[model samples]
Target: MGSLDVIARALWSALLLCVISFSSPLRAQPEPIELWHGRVKADQPFLDKLFKQFTAETGIPVHLRYIIFKNLKVELIGAAFSNAMPDAIIAPADFLGHYKELKLPAIPDSEMPDTIRPRFLKTVELDGKRYGYPFFYGNNLMMFYNKSLVETPATSWKELRVMKPYYDKRNIELITFSYQEMYWLVPVIGAYGGWPLEGKKPMLNTPAVISAFKFYKGLVDEKLVQSDCNLQCSLLKFEQGKAAFLIDGTWSYKRLEESIGDDLGVAVLPYIDGKPMRPMYSSHVLAFPDYESQGEKQTKLDKLRDFIFRKDVQRQFYDEIGQIPTHKELASLVEHTTDPNRKAHFHQLEHARMMPIEPEMSHVWQSLIRGWERYSMHGFSAEESAVYMQKTVEREIERDTQ
Candidate 1:
């Protein structure tokens, strides 16, 4: 009788334990920190290496989705509207304000370099809140010259003209930039103290800008710059020793180094009217989206803060991806590197200006290109082109506003 009672009690207790175990929740996996990156698939390995370190250090899982730069803004806008946005986005600084207007919270990172503060502040700050933190910031134009072609790089158009005979003797062009594209024309126009806009209003007809165009026309007239070449053709010419000087951004540093090796050199654009041709700079920044979950936001903020601000991490990006580091302390290291073929782009960056980030800017690119086409292909005089550019920009900008 005692054995039967004992056995029945033991069996009941085992069944109760089985029921409790079945009712309780299974072990839940850690949620991935959702991140959106505009890097292409070819960059997947590098991105994987970058994120692996962050995950290793924090034990936080990260899921990075590839979105190309061209589609980043529109797709992100759609995501914002649909409430399906990522916790963080790695994007060019151009859209910082746009994202801020979308109500993405900007978490302040006092760890950022003071050198980067002004640009970030100018782009993202409103009423004293910064909306983006600096990540890596060096895609601006500089002059790359082949030492074998010229003893020294020309310091001005005047010097370039005088040296033209040497290249001409060798059947080489003195300098062959993408003459038709207006994108790189800023430095030349800015050399004369003119820019495309004056605070959302078009300034294409500024006397300085007109003079800038005439100056280029003179170059074309002198046969110093090729009028018919695109960037690829010009770059090919430079690579083939058919040209000596090329104007391109820091993004080409490694490629040129690979092509020409130690013969390559980088310097600021030549001067005109005592002002250097200061190109506009573009940079990457860490931006956040307003997340519904506080924990997700915190996880993103923590991971980005931990990964981007480290001196070692910045150095790793510089070494591995050839991304110029924005941390002030790393600047000197890059500037002083054994590679004369490369310079810390920041020194030249100091003289450069930030592009207009306002909504009207979306209208300026196509309008200016069209104006240039009218002048070159439709027989508009310099004065006529200047006036046409002014009207077109204003009209397009007005349209954008409406």
Candidate 2:
């Protein structure tokens, strides 16, 4: 009970308390990874299932924050500037170029399994380093027509032209968007052996581009296509049964199924000649933010990445959300041939094309779409529109390069 004995006993008690605190499960547990994603209704079932499965297996909790697609970029940029970015994000391929410019954290091809990397049509890279893992890829653009009304589907754009009599007699129009005019144009451009874009340049000013523009313009000029057709209007026109053939992505399959039910007949978008041009394909990728404390975050991010690509989760994603699986092994897991229309969608992926991932690619797409719009909406000459598009694209490329 002397002063020295009391001091020794007090020191021992303090050390014991420190050890207990260090070993406590509550104190040792890692923080949950924060995930930011778009709140698409199609993804809900998959998210619920995957989150439950992920938490159960890895013991790493995921906190999800949903942001609208339009606002997501702005919010994410603000978060990045403030050093408050999410641990992981799910965004479209178009936005990947912006993330590349910001130098975000990404999982490279070398890091991913060999089977998974090759399935991705577009390489998700930034500064020669891969930055994202692709999850859902939809490249198939099918023409949805009412089978009961139209007995035979058009196999080519030329065949589509022949159906003008049927369309005019029946007063049925083909619905399409100016932006998606690329789908119809691609086949024609390919028939004439033209590329959508040349090496870092837009090539829409070519003879092929002019011809394709004129083809669509002729449809409008002849009153075969609806004059007010744009992205929103086209889909609406199709849903209302005013149009026979609607050019749209595979993502519209579920919505169409729910709305139109068995009345819908799906056909691959036809080529100009015998060969069809590939439909533009892109995917949603998971990427990490550039973190100050990367070491700890990397460990959690790697675990989440692995969990996402697991076979069971990928299968669930395909089944619940019509998102095409990225895992090569799971690609065939979508084989529910019960629905012939859905089965055709899987077949269409064989001839799909991914959009260019270059930084100036958006400008290229915009310029091409503008040219098509001017030719279709206004009375601009095809040659004039093509020249304007090519010049605008060249300017955009030069600006981005500088």
- Candidate-wise lDDT, in order: 0.74, 0.72
List, residue by residue over 1-402, the lDDT tens digit for candidate 2: 699999999999999999998888675576888888874555666686678778888888888888876588778888877878888888876567776444575555566756574647354654565667887677456678877667887878778778878777777775454444565556556556676865455678888778767765676677656555665577777888777888877766776776787888887777756776566667778878774357777887888888788877777766766677788877655655667776767656666666656667778777878888787768899899988998988887787778
For residue 333, model 1's alpha carbon misses the true position, in angstroms, by: 5.5
lDDT at residue 24 of model 2 (Cα atoms):
85
Highest-lDDT candidate: 1
Q: What does each candidate score in C-alpha RMSD?
A: 5.3, 6.4
The candidate 1 region of ten consecutive residues with least summed lDDT is 111-120
Give the TM-score comparing model 1 with the true structure, all chains together: 0.78
Q: Model 2, which residues run further than 4 Å from truth? A: 1-32, 68-84, 106-110, 117-122, 125-128, 164-192, 273-275, 332-339, 377-379
Assess the local accuracy of residue 74 in candidate 1 as a C-alpha lDDT between 0 and 100: 85
lDDT of 2 at 140: 50
lDDT of 1 by residue, 1-402 (tens): 999999999999999999999999998877777888785444567778888888888777789988866688888998888878887778776676575444566555564446553544564443456567766776678888888887878878788888989878889888888888776777888888888765666678788777777776777888989888987788888888889999877666666776887788777788885778868776777766774355645755666666777889888868766777777778667867776555435567777887766556656666677766776678888788888887888887776568
Clashing pairs in 2: 106-131
